[model samples]
Target: MFSDNREQLSRSSTFKLLLYFLACIGMIYTVFVHQVYLSSDTFHRKQLDRELSQETEIFTALAGIGNIDAIRTLIAEKQSIASPFTYHIQPISTQTASLSYPAALTGDQPYFELSDLKSGSSLLLDDDTILRIEINRDLLQKYREDLAPMMISGVALPVIVMIAGAVWFAVNIIQKLQRVNFAMNRVLCGEKNVKLAVSRNDDEFDILSIHLNFMIEQIEKKEASLKALTVGVAHDLRTPMARMKLRIESLLALTSNNQQQQELEACHDDLELLLGMFNGLLEIANLNSGKQLISKQRVDLTTVAQDAVDFLQPLAEEKQQQLILRQDAAHQLDGEPSLLFRAVINLIENAIKYTPEEGRIVVVIDAFGIVVIDNGEGISDLDKLQVCEPMYRADKSRSQSGSGLGLSLVDAVMKRHGGELVLRDNSPGLRARLYFN
Candidate 1:
């Protein structure tokens, strides 16, 4: 069966976060264990010293009394302690001995001792039983066995707590990130209004969610713009193209020579204007469509601007328009060389077309981007949206200057680079900025 059965088994962001927490917990656990071992070792050593101290006190007190029966009485009356130890007294003046030990020791009654515990267990004193009360180290062996479990529990409990705490924190953060992930996935599934349900905080994730949502909003705007372009392109392309065909046929039917010549010239102008409009539409369509792949490469913006200015000088001079190229900053961009040049040229051309004769037009690069400014009557804000539609002109009757496809081409080029071309009004003219990110 064609199924993604294991897909869900793959770790969620939650699981991954939990795993990371577990890893950190594991590291902390190792350190805790080391400290526990060190503590246990130190405690066990102190316990051994404690056993020897009690033995010394008891043995000394008995020797001071100097009576065999008194030593027996002391052993019988002494209370048992947490540390494992045994007391055995032997009269050494004669060759007689006695032994006693706790039930925890290993022997017939789980304990064993020699009459002279001094000689039976020699690990500690090394046969130095002369003129001193002697003791055995069987007590020390039992001490380790008694304290082992308590020491293990001390280290184990904290490890459990550390892991639990790590898991708790991991689960909380993972839940937040998962919400954002789902929101984005919903957007891809045609859910336009989906939003990351992030709580208000100044954390890095919160900042990321904000920026990501902002980007989604921008993408929504561009998608809407492209949808509107279809209707706009159809309307703009049909009108003048329809007019040219009608105007030409009628002019061809005229018989008077001078009148025919004048009519024919008008017809030629309309056809030329129609052709220019189609060419601009074609340029924009090719750029936006998947059909024409741009041969993109790194390009020096300085050289590109200079070339565009040089190429447009003659056209600018024809209309007594001055094309001023100003470089405020150097830009290195990546795109098809020809397309970039054409887009920039169209921008300059649009400015030249709208500005009055001998009016100033400036083309400059800046930190913001490349800008084309002109001292012409600027477009109103309401009409700016209509400007990028192929062959769209607000004042369609006045066809003395623009075929109205210049801005359309510029918009397409900018959109392809994940950038924008904004037509903002200068106080007395139009200011166009082309941003390349």
Candidate 2:
């Protein structure tokens, strides 16, 4: 559902690592809080101990009174002062200790009171009632409120420091990046000697700077070589071109016979093809140098394919071959219209040249895609690999039909737009599919 964001992630490694550490801290702090300060049963047990002691003293006071009725009256009167203390009247026994302390005392409120038999001279509860002591769930909450902040502070401070440290490191990296970017800008603005500072950490940024400098060095070498080549070739080819032009003009003037005229026309054609090849080479260089930017817009592949097929129909008919056209998704795209049309035309023309008079050419177009299929003998895999290489041709003579640079030019055009020419075997024919975005 998503593209690889590895490049972006790599750029923000420090920030990502810091966030990871912060998340771990938060989790550990949460677990600590839950364990240390949030336990209710422990609170209940402690509260029960306190209640038990207080109830023992109260029962001792009531035990000295021998009148059971009088003692019951006094206990009833004091019930309000002893909240959460319960008294249950039953046959009290040593075995009842298992039922134990306050039966309903929660963690917060411990249930504790007196009970026993008067016969033993011990107040059953006061004169013959049993008492139970226990703690309840409320004691836990009471303890939690008192200790929660202390526990959180103890845990969260370290975590907060760690998070802040991560953020600080990220900010440091960002500041370093800004400085590096300023240096790069100065270099781009003609300060050729400007270079990035090398960091000693041996991290990815250090590797990137080293590689970038190496690339700049290579580019400088290539640029020097290209300049020398262009100047040398211009000097060499200029003389030959001028001499050929003079010879062609002279031949036209020296004879008006049909035979001489045909020869001169052929000679001119050869020189013109040479000029075209050189011009094509220059265009390829322009593409490689990124001087030519493609206009990126939604282009209708169907419309472009149909137009190409129509342009080749007359040629196909002259060759006694049928040209079939099919198209889909007539949507527009971000592209150079003239360049795209020229590319399509070149493919169709190439197919026509290879196709026999009785053969068929099929042109297909789908939304944002195109394919030109032909019923001519297919190209072998080895030949297909080099088919788009400049000046490379499987058929050496080219039957005096094409300059042998057509596919190469087309490949260069599509590549500039981030597209490619896919050569596939179409059974008895060759299929040239151009995929574009």
Candidate 3:
């Protein structure tokens, strides 16, 4: 069986355009060479005709002087020069003027002999003498040989210059594209305000930079507006919710029936949950808005990981799960200790909540980051992307009792410290990795 061996070619516009330009130059060179050949052929034919005419004038004048042998001698001398013409002289053989002519003039030779002039020229001399001259075909070959230097100078050199110019233009465009790509990548890597540098020339790349800067500006504006709206809404709602919680507690104190007391207690619990959700929203908003400043210092990740494990050990034991710490080396990173601690706590808590009873949770600290893993039902592939989004929880963890904003807050803290929180499968479990840079 034969295989389909198709592959994608380069999609760069600069490369494609350069290829097209070279093809055009090739076609133009073909046409130019054809025209040059035609011109050179005409020029050579004209030179041959002039040479024949000069020889004829000299032979006629010499014959007019009534010295036939002298004319023959002159023809022999002219033949010594490097010329395509060959001359022949024949004596009169008949008394009749026409009868004494060469066989070519007597209609004994084919018309092509005269038409192509390959059989030489024939001149009628005094005393019924005939003189014949023929042009050598090698002269045509010589014309072609002489054309090489002319074509190189007139055509090939210019084409080479044109191709070089096209290559330089393509390289310039590619460099501009590379700069644009670098700027976009920097923006993607958490530099929200970064934009392409614009020049005053207003060329295509400059125009592109202007557009990109405008787009980033609009995005930053919209993001700020959304954060402001979220914080405002959470703050406005929390006041009334707090008053409602106080009223419910007061009601619980005044209630006589045990049923009413239970209802008041449930109401208070609901209020507390709502208040906690609002607080989480506010915390994330402040972090995003750059209002939650971090006090960064050199902190050992091993200590942080160990402390988080120790703090959550009691909860892990209550569920009959193993909380273990594995440190390879003492790794230090510039970060806010309180924020990093909170992130570690969230990871460990999430691991404990998802892992089955008596499951093993491992906190591993390495040279670059900390990884909290558990031998539990890991998150599905579909939920991994949305895990950091606020209020996003895996289906298996939906039944557990906790706010879904734990990982979301942890993600915010990591970003605030210029780090990343990665969630992935640990083959048989989930691995939550925090990379500090």
Candidate 4:
């Protein structure tokens, strides 16, 4: 779950925005620290350098005046008072060094070793005596010690607050987007009434929700208008088609001319096909409009599959195909028995219509759903995406005799049952599954 959440966050624009903000903050903080350290270091180093120069001049003047005793006494006084300075005196005639320097400063070091926490200067007087003065960088150390906490709080506190705020903002934006996504998914699933929740703040997200709600409303209105028009046209044509079918049947009963009878029978069959298409359109429209309430009961899916197979077995056998059912146990779920049976029948019929002679068709029943697999010229990848639409016939199935509402009606039935019809490519065939929730 954590990994999934992390992945989602990584893909989120809000999270990316936060990362960019943090990068900028980090850059600013680095530059700020560098500048602060440079300014503080330069100030303290210059101050220490000036003090060292002054101390060296004082001792040099004493050596020039030949007051060596005064210089020695002053050095002794400084050592006794625990001053930060250390002194070293060397005479060229004696070729020996005075051991007055601190243990940490006993080397013949350069004038400035700032990194060693010490700075020094030396002068050669007229008496050929060398004087060196070194001072501990205690002031710089103190400044660093005092500035550490300030720098930490200065950068850390703001960073922490910004991170917290950014996290909250990202979460808020993601939640709003998720709600919108969920609503759109419901709409896609045929629930046109679903609407996004609008918050009272009227922020951008809320505005987006409002606009989406308006769009859904418009879509619902247009769909209702279209469905009404379709239903109306079908109803108007249905009566005339029924009359035509009856007339053709009457002519068949009256006239015994073989050719005329065959033509009339063909006309009757065409009329029946037209009537069936109209009825299917009306059924789908009623199902989609929620005007038809499904009466649900605990129905055994295996029995429904058995019924469909038994009904369609003769048709499959006529095509020299095998109709097989594989069910280990009875899987019972709450659904409309008639609708479930119709959906299964439609799927099996489509399989029989498309599969070649000597092909195999299997109906598998499980706890979750029913699957109908057929070894036929399967639907193309492109056609599978739109084959379920009303009156949409794939190129492969175009020459076949169908109004092209079989899959659409099955889809409607599944929706009415709160299930789904999923079509898959079974390698060399088609696999259709009816998944029930």
Query: Best-fitting candidate, measured by lDDT?
Result: 4
What stretches of model 2 exceed 4 Å from their correct place?
1-243, 246-254, 293-298, 396-401
Pitting candidate 1 against candidate 4, the one with the higher lDDT is 4
Better of 2 and 4 by TM-score: 4
Best by TM-score: 4
lDDT of each: 0.67, 0.69, 0.79, 0.81
Model 3 earns a TM-score of 0.77
TM-score of 1: 0.42
Model 1: runs farther than 4 Å from truth?
Answer: 1-265, 396-400
Score candidate 4 by lDDT.
0.81
Candidate 3 pairs with clashing backbones: 120-133, 120-134, 121-133
Residue by residue across 254-299, what tens digits does model 4's lDDT show? Answer: 9989999999999998889889999999999888778888889998
Each candidate structure's count of clashing pairs: 2, 35, 3, 0
How far in Å is the alpha carbon of 288 misplaced in model 4?
4.1
**Per-model root-mean-square deviation over C-alphas:** 15.2, 11.8, 6.6, 6.6
Is 1 or 4 the stronger prediction by TM-score? 4
